[model samples]
Target: MKNFLVHSLLLAVLLTNSCGSSKINKTSNPAVPAAQENVSNQAIVPAADQLKAYLPLLKGKKVGLMGNQTSVVGPNNEHLVDVLLREKVDLKFGFAPEHGFRGDIERGEKVSNDVDAKTGLPLFTLYGGNAKQDSIVKSIDVMIFDLQDVGARFYTYITSLHRVMELCAKHNKELIVLDRPNPCGDQVDGPVRKDDKFKSNVSFHKIAMVHGLTVGELAKMINGEKWLENGKECKLTVVPVQNYTHSSIYKLPVIPSPSLPNHLSVRLYAALCLFEGTDISVGRGTDWPFQVVGYTNPVYGDFTFTPGEKAGMVKHVEGKGAVNYGLDLRNINPDEFKFTLKYVLYFYDKMPDKSKFFARPEFFDKLAGTDELRKQILAGKTEKEIRESWQPELAAYKQMRKKYLLYPDFE
Candidate 1:
């Protein structure tokens, strides 16, 4: 079984790499002048200036924008909805993702529908029950999604995109994805979601946990693969970001989500989220969620407990507080780095006081997308051994993802 999993992963990786070279013919080339390209390439101007190409296409269309705070125009931090409205684009509805339109809601908290203070438009909640379906978007001609994705598969924003795309296909409505940079770039990592075991709003389709595609690229992949219900396809239009390469990490003025305030939080989300399966606080109900993980107990050895204003733990080290007990390696060492699966396995192997670490086996199993990660942790497998067990499955997933990638190969 372990050998089969490793082989499947390898095959997927190879397939993904091969698919990067495949290209589809374009029907018609939009007339984008050389001056515009030059202007877009300039570092002084906003990298998102390429969105101007779609202005002619969206001039007078009744549009429903599916976005949040991060959906801004450029360095001026101009709101996309406001820009469309000012341009007489007939902006109708605005859909807010998990953290509400303004990105104020806390994690796991329900966001209620309300009227936007600035635009006076009714803001719909896509995070709640029955909200992520097609029923809410029936009043508009085109649904434009412009949220910033942190490039993690389990992040709710990607799932929100997935459901919105599915709904657009069902309603036969035109879907426009305003492309943004993937902060994590094109580095695929971790395991793919298994078909039979894990399927949720978070893990809807089979993709690596740290999928390295921009939201627009993901939309293209999903449509090209016909991953929507009954193989349905939406009238998709992707407004690609000009001058934006896979290497560029865009520092947008608008916040993507509440918990993910900065690139630091986003960089840590994929690794730290593993603690969610454990009893650790994960710094929820505090200023920094996913930045720190700790519990109330002080009895655990090798760590000193220092209480913060909001019940946190700091290590014995200077300047570092107690609410943080786990590995705090922020800088990714490109030379020494392995895949996320291997990194996670290493962390699990070095975990201190396994008995004190409160992780439900079922919860860990679900979060990891399989029972294998959990079983290996419990079985006391060394990090090397655990990673060796997953190489085959990871390789298979990499190969399967090839045909779905939309960006140039950097690997």
Candidate 2:
């Protein structure tokens, strides 16, 4: 039986690397984006972002939304945008974050202003600061932010939420945060961003890397902590998730971004993404964008993946068309995940020449949210020593975080 299982696993890995796979099973008739497919609706109660939960708050308000493909309503999997327009919610315009409204764009790819073909609503990019932000805010009385966050500080969705909330506060408009589950639930691990100098599109706040809060909970913290300008809070309301605790495992209803296509990738992302600043490609331009990591040469490891085009498949941005050699990590169980550095330490130590491992320190530092992580790694610090250094900030962050939690906590 063990032999059979081992052969099966090898075959699966071979197929994954063969560039022969397509998106996981469809969520609808024609094809729903792979990210929209949820794992057994029975496992989760309703998310606060559902229209049923937030419709009353939206009624009679001129609503603008900062949402993406993850915002769905009910078991039919109908989009919230569609449901609102149908019910006469008077949604004025739409705002998109990193992945664009439909969630198809690759990581770091520019999403241009466009019209929603289905609703004909004007959509503006919120991935960075939108130029027409002032005008857009003035036109709407209320803004709704509903996106599934992967519970990492640097995931960029929450950063977009921060920027949007800041603008809302400046305009004095009420913003309602429709909460959803954090997939890496209740796992508040990793170092906090030490100071503001490290802020980027990735790390705009000083939260721990894997903050164990939902978007709504984090919004409250953002306000309660006066993490905004001049210590003014945005007029905010957070509709809380039902039947959720800090520890509930949420299978995401949609892919949070183009690269993070599944739970395993999302779990691995916070830990492995530090590699972004190094020479290793995090499987970009390949079918397994975030699930695995490798260098651009065959000598790097035992496995190889040659990326090719598959319609609707998001290719890696850095190593497109490059055959990368590294470990096959498709079998990793998300249930066993934690914020970790063992993988990076293992891979970096194995590389024949350390000089070629890192590409730029600035990008890595931004992702890490501290220069100390980079310095520690370069200084040959063991993973244990690095983890020990995060204790002081982690303790403080945990205390601050406790003040804003809306659900039963893991602690």
RMSD values, in order shown: 10.0, 11.3
Q: Give the distance in Å from residue 404's predicted Cα in candidate 2 to where it truly belongs.
A: 0.8
Question: For candidate 2, lDDT tens digit of each residue in 5-115?
Answer: 111110000000000101111111222123333323344554543556568777888988877777766665557677677789998877777767777666676767777
The lDDT, on a scale of 0 to 1, for candidate 2 is 0.71
Candidate 1 per-residue C-alpha lDDT over 199-306 given as tens digits, one digit per residue, 9 for 90 to 100: 655565577777777776677667666677677776777666555555554554555655555556677777767766666544544456545544544332233233
Q: How many residue pairs collide in each prediction?
A: 32, 6
The top-ranked prediction according to lDDT is 2
- Model 2 ranges with Cα > 4 A deviation: 1-43, 48-52, 309-316
The whole-model lDDT of each prediction reads 0.58, 0.71
Task: Return the TM-score for candidate 2, rounded to 2 decimals.
Answer: 0.86
TM per model?
0.78, 0.86
